[model samples]
Target: MEDKKRVGIWIRVSTDMQVKDDSPEHHERRARYYVESRDWQVEEVYRLEAVSGKTVMNHPEAQRMLQDLRSGRITGLVFSKLARLARSTKELLEFAEIFRREGADLVSLAEQIDTSTPAGRLFFTIVAAMAEWEREEISSRVAASVPIRAKMGKPLGGQASFGYKWHDKNIVIDEKEAPVRKLMYEIFLDCQRKKTTAERLNDLGHRTRNGSRFSDTTVDRLLRDTTAKGQRLANHTKSVGEGKQWITKPQQEWVIVPCAAIISVELWEKCNAILEEQLSKRARKGRISEYLLAGYVKCTCGTSMYVFSTAKKFTCKNCKNNVKVADMDEIYQQVLKGYLNDIEPKMYVEELEKAIAEKEYLLTTSTKKRAQLRKKMDDLVPLRVSGDLDKEHFAAIYQPIVAQVHQLDKSIPELQAQIDFERIQLNSTDHVLKEAKGLYESWTKMLFPEKRAIIETITEYITVGQDTIDVGILHLSPSSKLTSQHQFMGSWKLPT
Candidate 1:
């Protein structure tokens, strides 16, 4: 009796493929059939489900299979398709060399490439090159489509902006969200400060698209988006490999689609002018301190605090509050322990899951409502075209619907953002706790900048008072470092 050949099967499916029900089982069945047809025994199966073929770094099962192959445990490796093995040509060639060196045969059933023959090996390389070229071609085509869509005032793809909704392949304003955006502009223009504006918005129960409390950065970005002004600007950036690089396209090249402007052009310009002035003022301050707690520390006397020249003390410019840097560090460590201790990781995870589910539900309901509005607006289009509805009446009716759809567009993204944030927090809860402990223990070895960064990451700020030190804990997923650092004073006191 011939010895049954030991073979390993590798199965993987991308996210898109998985959603379509093209599961790993289908790949497994094919591999089993191929191996059994040759009277080979299945040594093991390595399955990667809903995982992208973009990189092997995240696939631990694939790594284990390779390790077994390298150890000469398997005589053959089999997969249903070449692309399933890897999307990159470079990785494919590397895998071929490994199989060749390990004395293992490579089999791709779809392409009918068996690496036991020199002709088959050559054909595998050609197929890998073709697969890679096809992937790049697809990426290029998708990237090129963005500007074209933007020019036509269609949905720019991805998440719809705040106060906008997707309808019949176009982006229209959401009525519910448009009021919120308009309020944001009004509040921002009135306050002329991102931090204060954020605080006021949050006070009014206004959460960002992600369902988190507003931050200065979020407020600033929302104010800066030209889309709120009813204009779609395109070609502001170009693809850079796996990322994008910003390139200021000429004004002439910018595709402007008239949107439902939430704020007037005049209001937008006025707000931006104030922002530019703030930027100029900040630029003039110059980067001077390398103190670990320079910008993060504040004085209870309502003044900015900085690292005193010796780096041993933090001095508040307005209140003459001074505290030893070491005192601040010790207090921070103690506060961190209490803060982390209060958080039950398991409960936190459950809470995050619940929050995510709630947001997802809200998005679904809002999307349905937006769809209804879209239908009404689409129905109006025919009336306008058939002269049954005059342009003014059509505008009066359709404008409100368009505004409502756009509002959902803003709301959906906010809910999605919150869901994404919570999911991330769930994943990192344990790591964050471990790192907090490590940061405290490894403080002595860290440089000033490293120490400052770690403190900034964990705590919102340290405030020095005449007899007390307040260290406010930045929430787990902090949006921005508190601008008015002494706004919330923690109960921690300085060592006498």
Candidate 2:
């Protein structure tokens, strides 16, 4: 039998009048009825009552809904209308992107849009494309003006570099900060280490403009800026996305605005030369992993084993235990084949689903109990206000209820977290099962890197004993996975 689609109902009412006319409960009921018509289960309800729709992506309820969706606790979201989901076009596009990436669905009743349907998917594509076009249009207009402003030596919409400030529409050195900036170059030249320079500056009680302790990255960025040498470069970089890293633009597009020099050009060149040499030396020593389980293998003595240079055996530094690389590889391949063939994903997922359902039920009953307790507490307040109860009586009644509510508050979240964790396991097992058959078929033909990638994906660790090899297998979703750092028992064992 096919599993019923699990979905969350979204309810956001911004105003008291809207609550009176439309109501969060009314919206939730409408969404629930729609879900029921399709035989989908309403797993959760995110209520954002009296919250602004203008920017709800950061709201606690919205975050919880997203978390549930991402963790696979729910696979879809149902709202009364698109506006209830989000009024902002950008946020609407973001929601669609997230749903699409997670292989989930979005259903809006009033708009008659369901991303599970072809027509609804088409509607989302069109809306997202239009939003992207609008954003690009605005971005291009801004980009066109940046070079002109840079060439004219005008402020380009951000604060000047740390040692300099924008004064009267001109870039000038900040007196107090310039000395510290110059000292950074001096320290780097003496020590030839960016980390050392940062530590020395921090020890001298110098901090960044934001008042944070200087770090190696901060020191490196300050050292690399050409503004210290008087030629301030602008329009040299472009951001790939919101909150993402910026990459260097084409050199021909760069604009250099002349500014006051902090240090001599000779000193700047010498410092950068040393940095380039150090980077080159590090790059020369870098090498790719030659063995399939280079990092995953560990000695049973609780130490990592590695194949030393010109050695064919993975040797443990602590216990002197060793295993031939080829033998270990052979054992791993046999283990991999058995592990992939042995996975009973359906049975495993059923167990996880049963656990999740139990936790969800517990969370629901606890929430209801808390609400009832809260109502009782509210009623007691009115009794005291009306002088129907004495202060001692009110206290006697309120304290226990408050204690029960607090306990429930803590327990309910714990239940929900357990549900979220099991749902992640359920999703990960599904993903690995779907991929395992193909991976096994292709394993013989895959190159070292390809095979290594799969090992990193499914393997928790490999422990090498004197006469036995044990492998721990854990298939985790890229978005949510327990770290292998936590100890896990081996799932496969072989006699050496």
Candidate 3:
């Protein structure tokens, strides 16, 4: 009997909700039936769960299936539909080329495409061309519709921005977030600095629509975006290469539709002017202020913390976890003390061991060279004793070697000193306690960069809650006693 065709099945569902639906199961059963009816052997099943078909490269299982086909593990590929395999025309063509090169057939059961015959090849070619054309047409329609939507003064359709939310497909003021928006504008106009404005907003527990912490870049963008000012600007660009490249049009081509403004035009202009001035200054100086706990701190709401300077505190962008610098200092000191005073002092010992290992690694090359030089000097002595060399000649070779050995002798002691210093500290809780206390006392005097580095080195994250502060330690995993993400630091009513 002729060998049965070997084929692999491919399937994808865009979201978890689809998994609960019987549609994916139905498609799989249909695909399996189609393969079995053709008397083909099922080689493997490639399933991409909860992944969108919009991007071809995002599916790992699909890529693996292609590899298997190329390696001759499977002679044919089958799927319920073409869209299940790929959505983009580029991806479709690429898949076609792969199957053609590998002498494999593709069967998309729903599309009735069986690329093993000449008639099937013609049908698929026509269908693929229509699919590519439809994609382009849809994109063009959407681009053409933007102006009409903008002219009607409605959102072109996406998640609502800060200070506003979607209501019946129209942008409406979000009463709760509006005040925060006003606060951001008022603070920015007052400070005339985007970083200061960002800090102030964070201090007040305001965040962007995405719940991420504010930065100067985000602050500047928010200040300059006309959407917040209740103006709809659309048709910013048109498709240039099907849907690949987008070239922004000139300012005169922009569509401006009026809507409910979050802030007055006068206030917007004032803030923007100051922002422009700041940008020009930064351009000249080429620098911006750095936040200490920028990425290390996470809000209880699962967003990063943004450092604000209004009340001298680092605050969560997504929650009301605002904490004063002095209070942070106190909490941080307590956490350090807890680590240093542990019964085994295991954390300190780990740090000491790391330091010892690092020094030992650095000393290896130098130590080897020193030993080699010493051996050479000893060989010279034997050469001199055998009368193979004159006294002056032996001295010539011996002096530089001795000097080199002297240099190694100096370096070897320094390496030993480092090793011993770390070793001694492992046994001394007093040393750890004294060091922590010194850092605490001198905390106020350290440079901003220095203090930030030290805090980041010891801490994984510092999460603030309503009644407590939690600090995550670096060396120990999150489970360590001193490294709890929710340890209570005595409650204090934070300043509003």
For all candidates in order, the CA lDDT equals 0.70, 0.79, 0.70
Better of 2 and 3 by TM-score: 2
> Could you give candidate 3's per-residue lDDT for residues 234-279 as a string of tens digits?
7665555323466778887688766788888889888888877766
lDDT of 1 by residue, 450-469 (tens): 76666765666566767666
- N/CA/C clash count, model 2: 0
List, residue by residue over 249-366, the lDDT tens digit for candidate 2.
Answer: 9999999999999999999999999988988888855587789899888999899999995758888988888877887887788777766676676786687778878877887888
Q: Which stretches of candidate 2 lie over 4 Å from their true place?
A: 1-49, 57-145, 162-223, 240-243, 259-288, 298-304, 316-322, 343-428, 444-450, 460-468, 475-496
lDDT of 1 at 163: 82
Candidate 1 residue spans exceeding 4 A from truth: 1-136, 139-147, 241-247, 284-496
Runs in model 3 deviating more than 4 A are: 1-136, 237-247, 280-496
- lDDT agreement of model 3 with the native: 0.70
Count of backbone collisions in candidate 3:
0
lDDT of 1: 0.70
